[model samples]
Target: MAGELAGHAGDAANHGIDLIPIVALLAAAAIAVPIFKRLGLGSVLGYLAAGLLLGPSGIALIADPSSVLAASELGVVLFLFIIGLEMEPSKLWALRKQIFGLGVIQVGLCGALLTGVGILLGFAPVVAFVFGMGFVLTSTAIVMQILGERGELNSPSGQKMVSVLLLEDLAIVPLLGVVALLAPHEEISLTTRLISVGVAVGAIVLLIFLGRRIMNPFFGILSRAKVREVMTAGALLVVLGAGLLFQLSGLSMAMGAFMAGVLLSTSTFRHQLEADVEPFRGLLLGLFFLAVGMSLDLGIVGENWQIIALSVVAYMLVKAVAIYVIARVLKSDHAEALERAVLMGQGGEFAFVLYTTAVTAGIIDGPTNAIFTATVIVSMVLTPFAIIAMQKLMPKRVQPLDGVELADGLNGSVLMIGFGRFGQIASQSLLGKGHKVSIIDNDVEMIQAAQPFGFKIYYGDGTRLDVLHAAGAGNADLVLVCVNKKGDATKIAQLLRHEFPLVKVMVRSYDRGHAIELREIGVDFELRETFESALQFGAHAIRVMGADEIEIEEMIEGVRVRDRARFEAQVLGGVTAGTGLLLSNAEDQARESGIAPTVKLVAAEEKEERAN
Candidate 1:
């Protein structure tokens, strides 16, 4: 009776103590999140910092890292699951060679080499295996976080990383399965395990075939309901149902979620679904990371600081160097390769879980486990510094095309170029607000489309100045270049700088590197045409039940804030600038500047609606 009472007391004590870490983590994260956002950094970085601060080895606020790591592992799982949900068979096949082949070779090569070093350092073979595999796994959390922040979550590199990360995440399941098969510690038969895997795969294939056939019709039925609430509920059912089905098949929940996502991807409403689920995904992901932060073990760190530090140094050096070499060999640009290396140099969250599991399973000893765990955590913490270091090491300068004009116009303060869908909207919006918008487009079709709209849309290459003069461009206040192509955007920006030196040019870019190129050429203001605002608004609207006007207004405000922030952050992070300077300078220049095109969108709509 006395022993039972003591056991109950011990359980309660541990539970109470566990809550301390959770509280501390949340407090720190709450403080850090907004501060980082104001500085234009991301929330993931903030969570990592919170982890470090709460870590027993650091501030000692949260001491039981084992428990923390175990819980935090779910964030990674859910992240991967969401990723799988995003991919379909056709898309999956397209990336198979890269994900399986390139990802396999990369992980294998990196792991083996790292393991060889561990062996030389006097660790056992099993220890080396654990260390090697753990180190080779890069952080999906960090990768996704960075992509989300930069609004490049759908870029080519982003897509490639998603494919690679998903394969790597899936590969973890097999690694454990294969290990268990090689050395059976459990009562389950090897044949049974094999059958389980086979069954999982077969079931997935069958569902995919059947789901594709039924999903369209299912969604069609919901659409006919003419009820948004019912449609949304039905959509959720499809996603959740498919996910649950995969889980029952002895596969990872993420794998199931991914298959469901893929099945849904075949639908015409794939983008809409992605749009629908994104808010839930983000909030869930944030909560997941918060949980991870709360799980850090402070006690372990205090006792093993030296070990953690050494392991972290070794892992970062090896992984970053290996990734840099691989990227260079793959023929990435010098700067791009360097950025890729630095960005992906950390040990992934999966490594932490794997290391802990292996240690518990007796596949690796305590010291080796410490080394792997500490290394991964430290590498993750150092990501921001690593990016800064890479930026310094591999600064890329954009060279404008030769013979591009430096200064040409004296009258036009703003030169609007490339008037297509984006351009027409821009011009109309600007005109609605009574801002003089000088329109230009290379496409004759665009000019023809604009002709009937009762706007004098000019037809010209925009590369030529005489044509620009005929359109009253010299008297314009600002240049809003909404061109689609990267090369053309660059050319026009450069040409304008040569010809219209006094006019402050606000240009649209393809992406970050493209903006960097424009910056190097000294474009006054550049905005990367990120698709995230739309995705972000859509996600928030569908999930949060945000009203239509509220959502539209949010998009407009978000667009302005995002554009303003991008402009300010880039310049501050470069040209030897600061955030205050960027903002003050931009505002001072645009103080007399009138309302933006987006500001007049409502009026334009009302006018057109009345006319119709």
Candidate 2:
């Protein structure tokens, strides 16, 4: 009886311990992500920190890193799937040249440079080549996550980066073949290579066919079933299934998922698939980062610190320089080239696979693999900081104004200082009324793009006094400072007031506080950029919620009056001074008022307006 009781207790304790890891992971992520984000370090670093804390190198909260890494890889697969969903076949076709041409050249150049560095570090030629090539494969997760967070994934530069990443993914197969060929003991015959290549090609064709033919019908059936969970399950099934197919064929799981996404990009179910997989993708991706953090073998790093540090610095510097030079040579601007270089400098998760394969094939030793792996991790850790440094240190590049007309001596009644969306809209009414409006902008690309659309915008930095005068700001009856940056707008407004005192300055305010600041500075007219639009939006929302049109209009007017009063109070005192003008839905406050809510609210607002 005593033995049985002890056994049961032990079983209960073991089960409870299993839950500890899950709790620790959640708590660490919850605590760390917000704190890091608040510090401007970003969520990726937070996850990594959490992993490091929990891993054997820290507190050993999670003893097994490999299991976590294996499981978390699904996050990468889902991430690729979502990326593919955004890339339509048309876009992929459009990017073919960049993907193949730029991608291949970048890889070849970076790989060669990195390999030379490895050889100088005392590795044999073949081992150095493996090391170099491994580092050339940039971390897709890190780059993509950063790009997504910054909302740059759809930009031209962002698309180019994505193209390079795609090429890297495809290169993994051939890279593996190279590894096989380089294996000293293993005899890889020409016939075997041909067979492997044929298999990979056939698998790709089969996947494309099945994705085109079967996936939509399969999703259609799942949707018709009318079960939300089942639809989600089906989406996961497709992602995982596609990933598994590629993994078996010795290609990247991410590539398979990407291919799956591209095929379904034109499907009606693409959005639904993306929505279903997003939550999983986020959670898993976080887990993946944590696993990578945990995988940093502190013991190996401590012993091989000097060599590891040297390798990381040398590899990253070489890779970065190569990337920057190649990008510049390929017609990328200095800023774009530098950004790409910094972002793609670090070795990626794929490096682990290459390193491990090399070990298995007698190409490198176990200790060397561990040191190299640690080097990659450290590089990954430094990437966010590197990006931050690059942004702070790098000056904004001014594009060549080859064919763009400079804002030279001109005369017009209205000198519009910016030609952004706001300025474009503001100029329409002035131009429609046959008013002479001179438009000037510093963005050469925007000017060129707008030229075909009949916008006669000239290139000029509105913040500069000379540029303003050259753009006819001195002679204009009214000067419109419609630039988006508050600092620029403020500078222009101040400059106009000090120099062109006779000219009326109408400025676009970024927000309510900005509007108040502009008013305090004594601009002739200042409008909060989104104020009218927000009011219209609120009214439309009330209308949609079944309010009478008259009631909606009354509410809108009331809001406007109250807003004006609040703004005046805030300007006189501070932002907190207008709290009394705000509406309250509390029953106690309503009872204290002793009048119908609507009447009392309007009366209070009107009274506030009058007092102001």
Name the top TM-score candidate: 2
**lDDT per residue as tens, model 2, 106-156:** 999899888899999999899899999998999999999887765556667
Tens-digit lDDT string for candidate 1 (1-612)? 334534654686777753544455567778888787666456876776666655554555444556655444444444554565446577679888778876776687778778877787667777777777777777787887776554344445666566667777676676665445434275677689778889888878877776778877787677667676776676567656665676577555556667777666556555445545655566556655554554444455567777667666776777667766776776666665566667777877777656766866667767666656656766776787777566666644442223222223334334578877666665666677776555666566656666666755555555544445554555666878888987567656755665567767777888765676677667777766765555566657655674676666665565566555665565434323323322234433454585333222333444598899
**Overall local distance difference test of candidate 1:** 0.63
**C-alpha positional error of residue 188 in candidate 1 after TM-score superposition, expressed in Å:** 7.1
The collision pairs in model 2 are: none
Which consecutive 10 residues in model 2 have the weakest lDDT in total?
1-10
Full-model lDDT for every candidate: 0.63, 0.87
Top-scoring candidate (lDDT): 2
Stretches off by above 4 angstroms in model 1 are 1-30, 51-92, 182-190, 220-250, 365-371, 403-612
RMSD of each: 17.5, 16.5
